[model samples]
Structures are given as structure tokens and as C-alpha cells.
Target: MALPDLARRAASRPRLPSLASQRRVSLCETLDRVLNKGAVVAGDIVISVAGVDLLYVGLNLVVTSVETMRNWKPAGTPVRQPEPLSQEIRP
Candidate 1:
């Protein structure tokens, strides 16, 4: 019996980036450049319900910091997957 070449096997394996060497950022902010904070216009199509007419709507999204997210999880606790439902199928 012949043994497999260990050097060739190791070379074929993929190398992953080190977790410690990765960029550590407490918070990352991404701002909208096209229109940082402004209002948008919509086509003229007015419809009234009861007695009020719909005009316009705008939304702003804000992301929380990394430290706030990490604190949410309990320390040294394992996540358990929910068990599948037990049901009988009709033929």
C-alpha cells in the first residue's frame, strides 16, 4: 500500500481570513449621497377616503451599533433549533 502525499493535500485546501486581523469597527455609517435628507415628489393622483386625502410619505432608516447588538445575546448560551411539528398526512 502507498501513502498519500501530505504536502499536495495541504496545498489544495483553501485558506480563510483571520478573525483577529479583520477590521474592528464599533460603528459603520453609510449615508445617502444622491439626496442625503430631502423630500421626493410623486405624480398627481389624489384619492380621498372618508374625508382625508392621501398626499405623500417618507421614511428614514437607522442602523444600531455593534456593541448594542452583541449585548443582546446571552453569554455562553447555545441556540437551540425548534423541533418539527408532528402531524399526520391524509392520503
Candidate 2:
């Protein structure tokens, strides 16, 4: 079979934003977001020998700043909201 036209194929695809157009994120911002929202990593490891399972291990980890952890609340608990700057507004 004849080779497909490379230029024609590429032209059909949509163009992505150039580097200049994309927003740049700083390391501090990335860490702040991660700590603010927290991240959970969970996984399972299994070791087998000759089709027989020999060992199974599971791991779960949560990464966040101390302040973030302190603010965490269990399910069904009413969240406390900060008072609005304008006291005139009421629920």
C-alpha cells in the first residue's frame, strides 16, 4: 500500500496552545495547592511464586501540612464558615 500523506494527516489535527499562551505555575503554588487539598496514595502489592500467592501488601498514605490536617473534619459534621466581612447579610 502507498504511504499516508504526513502533511495532510497532521493538518486534520487541532493545534495546541504555544508555550507563551500556557500559564506558568510556580513550585510554591503547586505545593500550596497540594497541601491545601491534600493527596491520597493507595496501592496494593502482591508477590506470587509458581502461580501461588506468597505475599500481599497494601499501602495507604495521606500527604498534607499540619494545618490542613488539623482542619480536617469527619463526615456528617457541620462545617464552620468564616463570618462575612459585611455583617448586614444574614441567612
Candidate 3:
């Protein structure tokens, strides 16, 4: 077929519906999926510049539910509160 005929056929075809016109997800559902069932990423980053190693970084990430965070506490360590800012005296 000629180029003009191909272009005409393509233009006449129906367009697919956009995602906005489809189903909508609620904020609570999105948060639940992200915070509760999210993926955990554990990796390291190495930077090299001018044929020499410059910086090495270790990255560990954990994504969990709010309940897990609330119930988590360090072993054999007590939670300490910071002193009030007003109690500090400066000469």
C-alpha cells in the first residue's frame, strides 16, 4: 500500500482508553500495599573516579508495616528522651 493510504488507515483506527478512565485505587489501599507488602532493597554502592576507587557505601533498607515498627525495640537498650531545650544554659 502507498504511504498516504497507510497513514489514513492508521488514523482511522480507534484509540485505546487511558489509565485515568479505568479503575481507581484508594490512598489507604496504596499505603497498605506499599508499607506492608513492599520490596526490601539491600545493596552497596561503589564510586570510581579517574581510575581510582573514591567512595564505598553500604545500603540496607527495610519496608514493613506500622505495627512492626511500633513493636520493634532494640535488645537490652532503654529508650532515652532528649532534654528540654529550655534547660540548656549558655554563657
- In order, candidate lDDTs are 0.29, 0.32, 0.33
Q: Tens digits of per-residue lDDT for model 2 on 6-50?
A: 222222322324536544333333434544445444345543233
Q: Residue by residue across 1-91, what tens digits does model 1's lDDT show?
A: 1112322222232233453544322211112332343454445664323311111111111122222333456677643322221223579
TM-score of 1: 0.20
RMSD of 2: 21.8
TM-score of each: 0.20, 0.19, 0.23
Q: Comparing candidate 2 with candidate 3, which one achieves the higher TM-score? A: 3
Off by over 4 Å in 1: 1-28, 31-36, 45-67, 77-91
Tell me, by lDDT, which candidate is best. Answer: 3
Off by over 4 Å in 3: 1-21, 43-91
Better of 1 and 2 by TM-score: 1
- For model 1 the local lDDT of residue 5 reads 35
- Provide backbone clash counts, one per model: 0, 0, 0
lDDT of candidate 1 at residue 40, scale 0 to 100: 46
